[model samples]
Target: GIFFLLLFIFLFQILYWSLKYFDINNDASLFIEDLEFQDKLSEAIDLHEIKKSQEPAFFNPNFISDYKGYALGLSNEEIDRLHQYRKAKKWIYSAHEFQKITLVSDSLLMKLSPLFKFPEWANKQKVIGAKTKQQQFSEKKNLNDINLATETELQRVYGIGEKLSNRIIRFRTRLGGFVSNQQLFHVYGLEDNVVKNLLAQYEVKGTTKISLIDINTASSKVIREFIYFDREAANGILRYRDSAGIIKSWSELEKIENFPLDKIEIIKLYLSL
Candidate 1:
């Protein structure tokens, strides 16, 4: 009886160990499957992120924030430059102006410009309702020559106060009369929307004769006196002039390092070769 009892105990012990081994193997199998599933989920998430980035979405560049800029692949410096421009209360009217301010690469601009959604006024769309009665009357009377516009008359436009009107008039006079409507962009303290409103009513008549400065012969001081040009531009012109001996064509100035090419067209109105 003792031998039989001992044999029964040994068999029971063996059976318990076999069941425990099977349970452990089953748990290991489940853990391996779980790890595989986790890896696949991680890969799917990564792919989704990459695809989202590749797809372009329309956005207004003027309103870009640091986080948005980073997602759009803009450098920190480029983002900061855009923010600085906005902080000055200036608006970017076009993709070209955005590129000019941010100084982004041409390839990046091409990729991103298609996604830029500018304001309707930026497209030169006339918002009739936005104009004042005085502006509308002036347009109808054919007395919309900006060169002849008085401070009082200019103040009639929306958002054009006494200070802004005075600034515009002073700048116009300093420029010896605007040769082109494009010169309006050069006026200091002029808001982009205000300029648009003013343009809708008035045109640069070009009736006034302008005394353009001789580019080759003008002194740096004289060049700096022009509102469109600064000390840096004045120095660049002199350097280019010295190197080329004489600036025969306006296009040659484009080769000058750090030259403001965007302002060249308007700048040419006040300069002669």
Candidate 2:
């Protein structure tokens, strides 16, 4: 009877061990499946679309907090440390500074480097006092003919604000230059009347070999010079051409209101067709 009881106890121990092992295996499998499911769901989300969404739910503080928590799994202390580090350094610091910092990882540094201030260690390092003299000289130099000058040069023109300076630079890049005083209308914030007032003051020699009237496919600048059209009108013509297809004939100019008969006649001598 004693031997039978011992044999029974041994069998019971074996059964209990097997059941525990099976339970552990099942739990592990379940955990793996859950992880995979979450990964798939994360990949399915369109991050760009979510970022662009108009609703506060997409960009609100609460959503951002949840998103950071899910993606980084950073502790509150770690997050606070990162914030403190960022605050101590200028927002515009260079990538080198990021690399030098021991607390920041290479991947994280690369991601954050673009937002930081360019370090004083960067090339062409200029002293503050030295820069003032150079800037004064540059401004003095820019007071010369603006038509021949670069955007940086144009900034020196008296009464030209930062916004206006940027506009001039952009216009120069797009259309090449202010051909006629009329072309200034293409610049943002420069009102037509203001342009008309300023046109006589600034003289621009047209250097573009492609005359407005010469080509079947005229650029925005050519169209501007041809019809004395504003930026809006030039854009309208381009949009119309794109939508309806190419301009088949000069007579098609009639369809565009800004292209008057007299202007068309004046431009006919210069056109291809």
Candidate 3:
């Protein structure tokens, strides 16, 4: 009986030690799992911090520094283009204008545009919108006639001084009043931006009464009198008129080898078939 009791005690001790070891193993596995979860969480937090550090700050699109542009993922050429635009004292009022100036890719523009912070006036100028070419805004009320705008009024525009204003008036008088708004471009020293500003305030609202030159009968010298027509274009028109017999349609002039059909619309202002 004693031997049996001792055997039972030994069996009970073995079972208790085995259960204790098993419980310790289970607890160790749980601790390992917890430590692994903590490591993963720390890695995630570090990754988030790195990403936050890499994010670019908001900036004015007009005044993008080289480093800021690089951080924004803009190419060297695109940054140079922006610099050249601002060098001319031009302003970028919208993301569209910024893209148009820099020629940045649509995807990059989409990503960077949201971070642009423009001035209050620039934000208000958004109502004018932007275009790929020149920005053409509608004429406001009480705007003066460009054809009759006085030297004083012309001087009111930003780029035009006393000399430029007088020159503009002289050119208009020589042309017997401006036939088209584009004629302003013909005036020497009138920069495109200045012309855009001028046109925004004034326009060719009145028609100047003048006899249109008959293209079929007018001499080359007479044709050359118009600012758009040069000696070559004038001679080409005469040659076409001679060879084609009668210039029925203006399109026939397109076949005149070297004739400039590009200026047809403006030339039509002074000539007729």
Candidate 4:
């Protein structure tokens, strides 16, 4: 009983201190002052916050801030794609290339690209010894055969530069060579006007040399890998080939559902039997 009494006294002392420790202060200004002290301590911890209000207006889009990207209506995915693309040490030299990297829609490209403000040299076309677009063309012969032209020769075209010329040649190489002037339209960043100009200067005199796949025999993977045959179209082709027989002609391939009917002719260039 004496031990129990000592325990009660100890507990009472502990409870009193706990209650006093957590007692709500009635002095409102003290609470406010405590908050103000915390505010000052946070400011001292991160001084950069103090200068955030002094950030510049209208920074280059290449240096876009998160707030700027959000304000410009760029989705986080689009901004991330642009950043990932830029991480490759590549620069967006033109609006076309910017659109290619980010895959922003046409309306967005038009709205955003004008404000892009590419560096000055991007606008400057270098000529061996000339002042103007016409003079540059005059110095170089029109690119007659796109297949045989070097990157330097490709660059002679008004719109083609180092990056674009490499891209064109790389596409040409990938396809063995450009089979038609129309194929130039398929290069990622080439604009329609640029393609038209490319067509004017260059001709796809090289042979159409797409490595063909047998429609009846090739696996779905091979069929699907061809650009003309999307997954649905490829599956249809395989299903039809298995259910009916070898796709005897382009007409038969076209009859399959979602076969990209308009691209039938293009498909013919890649498939056989």
Highest lDDT scorer: 1
- Residue 29 CA displacement from its true place in model 4, Å: 52
RMSD of each: 15.7, 22.1, 23.8, 15.8
Q: Taking the tens digit of each residue's C-alpha lDDT, what string does model 2 give over 1-273? A: 999999999999999999999999999988675778788788767665677674332221111133463354434654555445544632212345334533546776565444443322222132223357766455444233446656555445555667887777666655444454334555668765554344433545455443334344766677676434667767767777777676777556656645533233334444564
State each model's CA lDDT, in order: 0.81, 0.52, 0.77, 0.69
Error of 2 at 106 (Å): 82
Worst 10 residues of 1 by lDDT: 119-128
Between 2 and 4, whose TM-score is larger?
4
Record all residue pairs in model 3 with backbone atoms less than 3 Å apart, i.e. clashing.
none
Ranking by lDDT: 1, 3, 4, 2
**lDDT comparison, 3 vs 4, better candidate:** 3
Quick one: how many clashes does candidate 3 have?
A: 0
Best by TM-score: 1
Model 4: which residue pairs collide?
none
Residues forming the 10-long window of minimal summed lDDT in candidate 2: 57-66
Cα lDDT of model 3 by residue, 1-273, tens digit: 999999999999999999999999999888665778899999999999999998877777876778978988999999999989876757787898899999999999999888887754454345535442333433545567887788999999999999999999988875567777767776889987898789778888766675678888887777777655677877777777778788887556556755654344455666677
Q: Model 1: per-residue lDDT, tens digit, 1-273?
A: 999999999999999999999999999988675778899999999999999999868877867878999998999999999989876756677777888999999999998999997754445423445579997667757548899999999999998999999998999888889887756766778878888788878888778999989989987788878777677877888888888888887657667766665566567777898
